[model samples]
Target chain A: MREMIKMVVVLTVLSSFSGGLLAAIRNNTKERIEYQQLKFVKGPAIRSILEGCSNDPIVDRFKIKDGDVEHSFFVGVFDGKPSTVALESFGKGFGGNIGVMVGVNVKEDTIVGVGVTTHSETPGVGSRAKTEPDFTAQFQGLPLKKEFKVKADGGQVDALSGATVTSRGVSAALTDAAGIYERVKPQLMEKLKTFAN
Target chain B: MAKTLTQEFVKGLWDEIPPFRLVLGLCPTLAVTKTVENGIGMGLATTFVLVFSNILVSALRKIIPSKVRIACFIIVIATFVTVVELLMQAFTYPLFLKLGIFIPLIVVNCIVLGRAEAFASKNSVLASTADGLGIGVGFTLALGALGGVREILGNGTFLGKTVFGPAFQPFTFMVEAPGAFVCLGLMLCLMNLVGKK
Candidate 1:
């Protein structure tokens, strides 16, 4: 009985000590990990979409709550004015969800550029949506409020050859981005004011 | 029967190296040794966990009851692994992404638990620390050498720089799964040949 008590007491003490140590380390690293994720996972897409911008979009960011989900907006400064914002949205692809980063000029309500952030589509086929620039380039300068769809389903966007599903996925993600932009435009404008030089 | 501190430390470098000599912790050794950078990163992460866990286990050896000692060792090792994961994510996000699930899998690495059960549990804190560090460095060097061979032959590059002229075609087979097994076999054979003396 004494052995059992000692075992129980020792295990309990060890577990609690571990828990406390982990909690402390986690608290310290949470923000830095978030930033690192942004800088690596989503940074390339954001950078490409906001190309030629004066400010580092990854660093100049804000989040707004839409219903229960919080959406992050990366501010892009172009020609000394912080007028563009890049946001990420996802759509169902052939293999999995495809993440698309969309940059829009807040003042003009037009797309500055678009880039694919993440996807699990088939290589050499569906993957072209990310690798082939010609496909995503079509979205540049388009009005942000317009519906996005592949040309196959009677829309303005052209689908990648042999990759209709992935192209449609990208269009769907852009459409989702439009709705998200409309919902958060007011909050975005308010936040961008702080970055004005 | 009692080994000196220097012997405890030095033995891990060659006589008791984790992967090559002991033939333990093969998962990360096989999976992440595709690049020199990845191999080294993984080795360092494991080293950190091993050393810290060794110290903690040795320190608590007196208090932990034998019946629940395994549970206590796991808790201690797991806490340090979590700490390493968080630190890697916070600072080395790219490497973290590359290492991915393998980092978490380190908890099950027999070398860690084996040391805690076999050596740290019996030895003083200082001796355990030396053993861990020696084993960790040995693991790192072994992984780095393996990665160098694979990367150079498979990609025709060393640390991403072209080792051969542009005219050289990469031996792509050296980068695949079967190649890993073959390379490891040859390495084990070579180690045995050299150690025969």
Candidate 2:
């Protein structure tokens, strides 16, 4: 009887209080979290890519068309131009998952910007390289026709002094983003045309 | 058993060390300990959760039922993790972002869960609280050791500043995943050697 009573007490304390608190907060804040994610993480990328146009939320899996990637992103339209797109790329790095926010200008066939959405790089080397302007600046203003390579390989970009592997991983992610944007560029342009009308 | 609460708290310093001796929570210990600051942050957050949850769980262990006890425990842990996440976001947003999923992932950190199962679930509330404090501090210290070595060697710095002179080039490997294993492995071996004494 004592054991049974103890178990009853344990379960009630665990469930009734903590569980109730989390459930209440989750229910109360669900909409706010959803709104913030939309406004902060995605919103800036959308505006940057399309330059002041709004977009339909991109889904990984849809009722009609499934979004293929795990992280969801949207495409934006502006004045009959599909100027920008936001997508996440996961690359295996020296450590683990390196998720990056890649924004591209489809019209120019160039990258708009790349930001570290999430990464597990080594603190002083690989992680630092991610934000180093010299490393990141290499992506900016280069059109689709330009070769993406470290100057060591006869390309324009200079690799970080010691973080080549991480830089390569990030650059590979950039290349992948460019490739993906190429595929959907046409549909994105069409969506913008409709919006302009 | 006759020791005061201060002794109970201080015992986590050597005996019952969470990471080295108990070997309880190795995931985040391995995953994020590339720097001492990162480890410290993770450790403190985890300790807060462990102390609070242990106290609450012991207090309520008499009232809970048997069949759904595991689910109930998870709910309690998850709530505290969420609370820490919110508090970090409001105050330490940068560090909050740096911690990333590891914050929520603390819900599964075996140290907190293990104590809940081994001590808090069975012992008096005061004893459980003491145990929680001991284990939590021990884990923090372990993380700090790992983080310290990696930060110093990999970047020639400690806690975001250059501690070593400019001439000391960093060993890149020390900050990588392999470094986490090698450093911890070496530390473990050193610890075992000391234990034999």
Best by lDDT: 1
CAPRI-style quality class for the chain A–B interface of candidate 2: incorrect
Q: Write the per-residue lDDT of candidate 2 for residues B1-197, one digit (tens) a residue.
A: 47776677777767678877777788898888878899999998999899988887777676556465566667778889987876665555567667888999999998888888777877778987887888788888889988999999998889999998879989999999999889988988888898885
Candidate 1 structure quality by residue, lDDT tens digits, A1-197: 99998898888888888899889999999999999999988999899888898998988999998888898999999898998999999999999999999999998899988999899999999998988999899999999886898888999999999999999999999999999999888888999999999
List the pairs of residues colliding in candidate 1.
none
lDDT of 1 by residue, B49-163 (tens): 9999999999989998888889899999999999999999999988999999999999999999999999999999999999999888888988888899999999988888989
Per-model DockQ against the true two-chain complex: 0.93, 0.20
Tens digit of lDDT per residue, candidate 2, span A17-129? 76678667776666555555555555544444445654453431111112574344455555544456567666666788676667666667777666655678889898865
Task: Tell how far residue B190 is off in model 2, in angstroms.
Answer: 2.6
Task: Identify the candidate with maximal TM-score.
Answer: 1
Which regions of candidate 2 deviate over 4 angstroms?
A: A1-16, A23-197, B1-4, B66-68
